[model samples]
Target chain A: MKAKKQAASIAANAGAWLITAISLVPFLLILLNSFKDSLGASEMNLKLPGLPLQLTNFLVVVEKGKLLTSFFNSCIYSVASVFLCTVFASMASYVFSRNRSKINRILYLYMVLGITMPVNYVALTKVMMLFHLNNSRLGIVLLYTAMQLPFSIFLIHGFVAKLPVELDEAAVIDGCSPMRLFVSVILPLLKPAIATVVVLTFLNTWNEFVSPLYFLSSSTKWPMTLSVYNFFGMYFKDWNLVCADIFLTSLPVILVYLLGQKYIVSGMTAGAVKG
Target chain B: MNKNKIYPMWFAVLALLIYSVLFVLPGLIGIGYSFTDWSSYSNQLHFVGLENFKTVFSADENYLKIIKNTLVFTLGTTIIKNILGLALAVLLTKSIRLLNFHRGVMFLPSVLSTLILGMIFTSILNPSSGLLNTFLREIGLGGLAKPWLTSPHYAFKSVMAVDIWRGTGYIMTILIAGILSISQDYYEACSIDGASSWQKFRFITLPLLLPTLATTTVLNVIYGLKVFDMIYALTNGGPGKATTEVLYTAVFKKFGTGQYAIGTALSSVMFVFMVVIGFFMIRMMTKDEVQE
Candidate 1:
């Protein structure tokens, strides 16, 4: 019986390592190929890159693939939209929690309902045109804000409800205006939820591809994901360049993931548990 | 103390206005336009009265097949990801070496852009000289290296597999959290009764983890129905007619070709369908939020 159990334990270890390999191999391929010359990367194999690694691949991709423009575009979209979502969601959800009027309840539900409602990108074109938001950086930012607000509001609304009503009572008694109370008293306490919101929203907006694909038509306005795909199409044969471009595109995300894994996991599993 | 005076309602105005105008209004207008012949092909709007819906529901059109593919992909990926995620969750929760590293590595794909992952998979699954096929040949399993994205019979499955790969870790992460939250008292009690390891899992773990599994399923279904980026990046709904096309990609095509009426109609189908789920989803998500 002990031998049988040991065999099972060994099998479990084997299974875990195998699955880890599946996850790590693709990334390793990208990293290895990014340093290879074009001929070296052509096979897309796991072999080590040649001596004097072609670090120039990143330079070529940055120039030819227009990586700098898209990287700037992604940064703008992520930062601008994350700021919009965090501030707006905090303010809105705070009101929804404290007010709880009939209209507010309905509005809160309406906003959260967007968590599952699929955006009609087709008709959205008409709205964007109506507002002159089509094909611009601001349009992408606004679209991402609209896309991310529901869940952000949901996350922060729950948190705001937990902040004691006495705090609000004290702030008001001290002649704190609503804006002052929120800024001085509540926003500091909401730092944790706001952090989660910022990180998650930034990641989502940074990784956004569809909105730019639909709305931002100018090549100059493309985000990293779009531009990387474009580069892949044009340089499909030069896997080295493509690897360098994707690796660079993914660098910000990898950094954020490592730094904010806690917030990311919490945000991801936020509504998952009934407990 | 007036609640209204302290917690003013106007604070919500910016978010509501943006959401209403940009997000909610488009869905409402799209549903409305489904009745009318609205298209870039013409400047005039004429009430068409369910003609678009008829086309969507018609037996002859590939729209029905596309709908089926979407459902199949959702159900297939959700179930497989949950099962595999559950297994991995249990394994990683064991007293394993580098436990955090394993879990983090597994969850990496979930954090990356799905479109980017699709591009990487496209390269790996290329017909010749791709890493996957090359590895298979090196291991003497070359016959199994099929044209992953270039064949009709396998295209849908291939897309589904890549999605499963991208998504399983997320489900696993949630499941691991759920498993960790399970109390140790039950295991102690079962072990005292001489329960086997499988028995402990079957009786204690599965039942307790059902809620998390359900949550993961909900997330997966919502993601699957609206899936576009991965499909767009990998196959663009190709390798044959309607083989891998879901509603979103098909709607994009309609929108691209100036067929606005059909596109809006297709979107309205998904809109109405998901709105029903959204009601339940919000309730599940906020079950403990209000605490009123």
Candidate 2:
């Protein structure tokens, strides 16, 4: 029985290692090919580079794809949208949680509609036309905020429910107005939940493709994902540049995930476990 | 300031106004436009009741195939994703070294843009000189290798595979939370009752996980129905449209072709379909939650 158990343990360890390697292999493939020359990469089948690293692919891809500009656009979209989403969502969540009026319930249900509604891009386009926001970054940002509000509000409401009402009472007793209480007391206590909101909003905004693709028309204003499509179109035959562009586009998201890995896992699972 | 006298309705109204302007009004207008003959070609508009719908539903127009494809893609990906996610969650939950590192690596794909993932996988799955084919030949399985994204038979499956790769981590993360949240006492009790590992999992883990499973499955179904970027990037509904075209992709194509009314009509249909399904799902899940 002891020997059998030992054998089973060894098998389990080996299996785990295999799964881990499978998870890492695609990323490693991209990393290595990002540095390989056209002919070398095409011939070599995802193997590590032979000797002297060829930095030409990265340079060529950057110049040809205008990766820096794309990166800047992505940053603007992600940062602005995340900031707006977090603020509005947190405020709405606070209101919904504290107020028990019928209006609050109705509003809560209305917000939840956004979560269930299939993103009507056609309708959104018409709306954008009406607002004269066609092909504008602000247009895309506003749409993202409206779309993301439902989930963010849900998460913040869950967190706000657990907070003690005494904090609100004490702030009022100290002559703090509602807005001041929210900023000075409530917001600080809701840091963890706010952090979760920021992380999720930032990640989603950064990785978003469809809205930007439809809304933004100018090549110069294209986000990283759209730029990848442009690169593919411009260099339809050049596999090397395409691979390099893919690597550059994916690098920031991967870096962010590595840095905020803990928060993302926790934020994603928080509601699942509790509710 | 009278706290009770102060109404929060004003703030709620502000949010409602923004939402109505940006989301609800457009959807309502879209439904109206679907009935009218609207397009970029002419300023003249006519009320063409059910004409667009008829054209869409025509058998010769390939709309039905698109709908079928959408359903297949959704059902296929949702099942595969949830199953794989559940399996991985179970494996990772065992006390293993470097577990956090493994978790990070697994979740990497989920964070990257779908368009980027689609492009990267396209290269990897290329027919000539792609890594997939080369690896197959090296391992003496070259016969199994094909132009994954180009072939009609394999294109849809290829898109589904990449989606599964990209999404399994998310579902796994959720399922892990669900599994972990179950009290340790249950597992200990099962052991004391002479329950085998499989028996314990079947009796305890599966039952406790039903709610999470329901939530994840519903979310996956919605995602599957609305898939766009992956399909667009991977195959573009090509190779004779062997892959599922789905309504959204069709709308994109129609808009790209400057067929605004037809495209909006397709979008309208999708909106209604999604709303109906989403309502049913939420109702069912919440009802189950209450019962539990």
Candidate 3:
């Protein structure tokens, strides 16, 4: 029995190590090859980058990929979308959770459908055209915010439903206006849920590809994902710069994930576990 | 009390305005457009009634292939990701050293854009000078290193492998959370009964993990059904349309060619698929939870 257990432990360790290696190798390849010349990166061996390490790949990627503009576009879209989604979602969640009206319940059910449904891109563009918002940053931001509202409302509703009603009673008893009550009392308590919303919305908007691709026709308005994609298309032969572009495109989200991994895991799992 | 009711209603207004305008309205218009001849060339819209649907179903039989590809992609990635994720979760939960590090490494790719992943793998899968081919040839398996992205037979599988590689970590993390929530006492009890590892896992772990598994499966299926960027980046539905031309890509192509009505029809079909699957998944999982 002891020998059997020992062997099982060894096997498990080996499997874990193997999985880790599989996961790490791609990132390692990207990192190592991003510094090498095109020939070295194409060789794609797992060796340390050679002497006279070329950092020009980053410069080349920025210049050729228009990475700075793409990065700026990503920031604007993600930040504005996150802000809009969080505020609107929080407000909606507060109402949905706090109210018991039949209308609210039905409306809540209706909004939750967005969680599963893919956006209707063709029709959406038409609506954008009607509003004269097509091919604009605001158009994309509003769409992202709308698309994300369902999930954010679902999550924040769960969070809000768990908050004690006695606090609302106390605030009301103190002659607090409903707006002030939410602002001064409820919003402060919703920090954790809001953090989750911000992280998730940020991640989604930052890494979004399909919407940006379809909605925006102008090259200057393209986000990092689209820019990297187009850049990769244009510069497929110069793989070192391609690697650099890829890394730069992924860097912000990767950093965000590494920094707020706990929030991300908890937020994602919170929604899953509840559902 | 009336004031309170009115205030909450006020809070809901902005969300409803945006949601109704951008999401619900577009969906309804999309369904409406499917029944009409809406295209780039035509100035006026004409009610076409089942024409686009007919094209999707019978006229263009290739659409059926795209639908099949979509189903295959969804089921293939969902099943593989769930199994691999569950296994990884079970393996990593065993007090493994550097478990967090391993978990983080596994999950790192999921955070990156799927487009970027596609680009990375595109180079890695290149026939002449790719890493995968180089490694395979070095190990005396040159025959296996075929044109992954270019060949019709291999393209779907290659794309699927990339999807699974990028996705497994995410589902693994979710399952890890689920597995951690299962109390150790059950395992202790099983051990006291002299239950083998397989027996304990079969009886305790699998049954309890079903709810989480259901959630992950639904999420994966939804994502798989909506997959566009990865495929677009990898092959653009390509090598003679060999790989999966999922509905979204089809819609994209249709729209590109100014086939607005057909694109809207495809979008409507996708929406229905999502609704039906999403509803059924939740219902099935709810039943599981109740039985438990």
Instruction: Count the clashes in each prediction.
Output: 0, 0, 0
What does the lDDT read for residue B50 in candidate 1? 91
| Candidate structures ordered by lDDT, highest first | 1, 3, 2
Q: Which ten residues in a row have the lowest lDDT in candidate 3 chain A?
A: A266-275
Which runs of model 2 end up more than 4 angstroms from their true locations? Answer: B1-7, B10-15, B280-292
User: What TM-score, over all chains together, does every model reach?
Assistant: 0.98, 0.94, 0.96
List per-prediction Cα lDDT, in the order shown.
Answer: 0.92, 0.78, 0.86
* Candidate 3, lDDT over the whole model: 0.86
- In angstroms, give how far residue A202 of model 1 lies from its true place: 0.7
Show model 1 residue runs off by greater than 4 Å. A1-5, B290-292
Candidate 2, A65: how far from true, in Å?
Answer: 1.1
lDDT per residue for candidate 2 within A74-112, as digits (tens), equals 899888878887888887778877765676756766676
lDDT of 3 at B165: 95
Model 3 alpha-carbon miss at residue B199, Å: 0.9
Interface-residue RMSD per candidate? 1.1, 3.0, 3.1
For candidate 1, what is the DockQ? 0.79
Residue A114 error, candidate 1, Å: 0.8
What tens digits encode model 1's per-residue C-alpha lDDT throughout A114-162?
9999999999999999999999899899999999999999999988888
